[model samples]
Target: MGARLDGTVAVVTGASSGIGEATARALAGEGAHVALLARRRERLEALAGELGDGSSVHEVDVADAEAVARAIADVVARHGRLDVLVNNAGYGSMTPATGSALSEWRTMVDVNVNGVLGTTHAALDHLRRAATGERGIADVVTVSSVAGRKVSGPAVNVYAATKHAVGAFSEALRQELGTDHVRVGLVEPGLVRSELTEGQGAAQQAEAEQELGLMEPSDIADAIVYMVTRPRRTAVNEILVRPTEQAR
Candidate 1:
């Protein structure tokens, strides 16, 4: 038998690293032709090579609306259909509002909130069109943070706000697209080990490893795979994943 996603095409933003990279790999494993999108060209090229001829790379910053739209269009033109879209590109810098840089706040809103909006908007027509195809359904999965659900700690003011905005958008989009056979979902991860966390020095990293037992990018990737692979009649709309020891 063929793989579950055989002949489907998937576009993953932030595909150069972390959860995005892992999701690209996982989706490809299930037989989707993956389109890798990120600002890093070399990393995306390397990943595309590993994913083989079925995959392609498009280096575009998610913060640029026009660029994202053009990239998505290119993916469709090359692949003939778009079955899945992973809005995984994001930015975050945790600092208390009193001392936080205004630019940092704007960056979070641009990449986290606006990026999701632009990419989803660009893919909407294609996704709905794909739903009318042989598979009979299409998917949109956004990578969010536990911060999106609640403000768990200090220094997360603007970051949390941005995440919350996407959470709201995902819900509204889910409702709006259900009748179109487009499944919209969000995967909220809590404290995963990725580029964001690797910035902590070795000493701090070791301490965090001992304390939280950080989840790997593949863990979240598995959740995404599960969401998109569900039968057309079923939809797994939201999944919140946290490390076993993570309390918040």
Candidate 2:
């Protein structure tokens, strides 16, 4: 069994599906009381029901700053404390820059970059407080992508840019919060089979699948579980996880 998170209260954004859904399940299984945040009220409610009494559902759009702040505040109020913040809400449309619609790029930046900032900013104080409490530490884990590490191709231009932006933000926050006993970490996943990658017939996608094989969302969730379960004195800074066959 994974290390217990019996008293921890976790907020998982984008919890309706994909990595967010998997992470929420993993955290709850480890004994955390999780707040599931997403725009899909029905999905969130269903997930909460599945998680039983230890979970709460909140309808939220990470792209809306004020709404996100309100949701985080609500979680803190209901739970009395926040122990883990997972910034997993994001969108990506891999269109070549030359032919891509400006709106698509804007969507990517709005959710992947600005959304992370708003959520982090709103949760920072609560996270700091959690760190000083009985847990003795708190965690902020952002689900970035391998695109954050390297620009794969022209098609991933805007998406890669947004991931890179959040990566930089996470690193800076890590440096600043290390002293506060708040661990800021990033999980860079490569080609996990999620809705984001569905329907994209990119050559890169095929190449990735053939080489490294696609990953299950649970694989990434396992990495997150590892990060948060460590002893109070240990801070897992970042994780770069990919399927064994993946070259990049």
Candidate 3:
């Protein structure tokens, strides 16, 4: 039998590392032609080499709306259609509001909030087209965080707010696109060993790692692959994965 995502074209933002990197690999394993998108050219090229053919790389800053639109167009133009878009590019600054640099807050909003918007908006029409075609469905999976569901801590103020914004956006898209056969979903992860978490102080990072036994990026990638590969009639809307030991 053919693979689950056979003949599909998938675009994954932030594909240079972590969840996005793992997700791109997982989707490709399912026979999807994965388009790797990230600002890091060298890293994207290296990963593209590892992925071999049926993989393409696009150097993009998701915060740039025009660039995202062009990238989506390029993907569809190169491939026949676009079946999946993993909106995974994000920035995190878990600093208290009082101590948070205004620049950090703004940058978080740009990459975390605006980035999702730009990519999703740019791909909506293409996804809808694919859904109505032979694939019978298309997927938009945004990498959110446990903070999206609830404020994880005091310092995650703006970070939490940005996550919350995406969560609400996904819900609205799900409602608006269900009839179109375009699935919109969110994956909320907690305390994974990622660039985002590594930003925490060294001692605190070690403590969190020791206490929670943090999840691997591949775990979240597995959830995403599962979400998009479900039967056409089944829509896995939201997945919140946390370390087994992580508590509120």
List TM-scores for all candidates, in order.
0.98, 0.95, 0.98
Please, what are the lDDT tens digits per residue for candidate 3 over residues 1-248?
98999999999999999999999999999999999999999999999998889999899999999998999999999997999999999998777788668999999999999999999999999999999998799999999999998986798899999999999999999999999999999999988888877877788889998988889999999999999999999999999999999996
Tens-digit lDDT track of model 2 for 99-196: 78999999899999999999999999999999999879999999999999999788889999999999999999999999999998899999899887
* C-alpha lDDT of residue 188 in model 2: 97
**Candidate 3: misplaced stretches above 4 Å?**
none
Instruction: Tell me the tens digit of each residue's lDDT in model 1 across 93-150.
Output: 8778887889999999999999999999999999999999989999999999999999
Q: Rate the local accuracy (lDDT) of all candidates.
A: 0.95, 0.92, 0.94
Which candidate do you rate higher for TM-score, 2 or 3?
A: 3
